[model samples]
Target: MVDLKVKLGSLELQNPVMTASGTYGYGEEYEDFVDINRLGGIVVKGTTLHPRQGNDYPRMAETPMGMLNAVGLQNVGVDRFISEIYPRIKKYRTNILVNVSGSTVEEYVETAAKINALDHIPGIELNISCPNVKEGGMAFGTSCPSTIAVTAAVREVYNKHMMVKLSPNVTNIAEIALGVESAGADSVSLINTLLGMAIDVEQRRPVLSTITGGLSGAAVKPVALRMVWQVAQAVKIPVVGMGGISNAEDAIAFMLAGASAVQIGTANFIDPKVTEKVIAGIEDYLVRHNMTSVAELKGALQA
Candidate 1:
């Protein structure tokens, strides 16, 4: 059997496939469709210091090849996650990661600190893409300095595997990834939905409540692949790539581009069992290529 185990900092995933935060909800939601233990990890929905009701109605819109979302990180506060949600999901055999988000650096740090105490949680995907309320609504990950500051602050309080998820809406995502790496991020996940919007010509109004929202699906794959390649080359830590991976071929391309692992986002909405199919397909490709371990696919692109 081809070895599929991969590492993200000190955490060793049985395979390199994981479910994106918002797309997969808690592990229990997909338990009937997926074998949760067979996957590498499960990143729960975005969590914050306090519960958020999220953006108003019509916050999501469909485009040509993708979807736009301004979900605004609606979630139970970290306290509820720790006391209620954690107990339900901690039983999964795979790694359980929380995608932590906040509008302020202090909020991020406090939320992450709480997750750090959970013995079952091995790490957190620090979502620096959240809008920085204190800074007039600019995303923290869009600014290199702000990214480092928040990452470093949380790194101080949380000692587990801290994977900082990067925003694709920046001019220099690689630079931001490097900043987080320097700030003590154990690894980095990239290409969080590109900023996009749609309008209703008939109604003469924006398609979504928020004029613009994050875009994800097959359309973002090319961009996500390029950014993952760039950041993987720019940083020493592991890279977790996600943005539109729908199949094993796409997942393999990210690994060859430089991602040590990949997260399936929009595709989950299409097929709840997509993650299982990808894991199987990866092993099949390894066998066909006469490869022994999936790790060999990392940065294997001839280019």
Candidate 2:
């Protein structure tokens, strides 16, 4: 049997396959379609210090090879989530991580501190992609100083494993990754989504309510892979790669590119059972390659 277990700093996962935040809802919605206990982890939808109404309607648009989304990180706030959502999902056997987001450094720290109190939540995927309202709407992950500042602030309050999610809109993603690492990130996941926009030519207008949105899916895989490779080489912390992973091959490609694990996002919308398939497929690939452990595939790229 292949050993699929992997260590993301102090957190050890059953396997390297996990459902990305915003894609998998609190591990309850997909209970019927997916075997929650089988997954390495489930990153619940984004959670904030306070409730958010999110963006206007028509926030999502389908593209050629992917989709554009401007959902605006709508969540039920951390207090309500701890009281209502946590009890239900905390019973799951696999790891459950919260995707913490905020428009300011204090908000991020407050949200993360609350999540850190949950015994079942082994870690948090700090989403620094949210626009910093105090900084003229610039995303916290885009600038090195901002990324370090927010990550360091959250790190002070959050004692558990901290996995910072990197945004792809930055000029040098590796530089940002290093910044987070220095500030005390246990691991880093990338690339969050490429900035993109869709338009309805016939209507002579943009498709999404927000003119621009984050682009994700198959089209972003190559870019994500490159960023993962670069970040993996740049930081000592394990790298959890995500963006557009649809199958075991795609997941394996990220591992070979230097990712310790991978998260499934847009593909989860298409097939709720994709995570199960990927776990099995990874084992199959290992057997075919005469390998024994999934860990062997990390950074095993020929080039």
Tens digits of per-residue lDDT for model 1, 51-112: 99999989988777879899989998999999999888888999999999999999998999
Clashes of 2: 0
Stretches of model 1 off by over 4 angstroms after superposition? none
Which segments of model 2 are wrong by more than 4 Å?
Answer: none
Model 1 / residue 221 / CA error / Å: 0.6
Clashes of each: 0, 0
lDDT of 2: 0.94
Q: Tell me the lDDT of candidate 1.
A: 0.94
lDDT of each: 0.94, 0.94
User: Model 2, poorest ten-residue lDDT window?
Assistant: 22-31
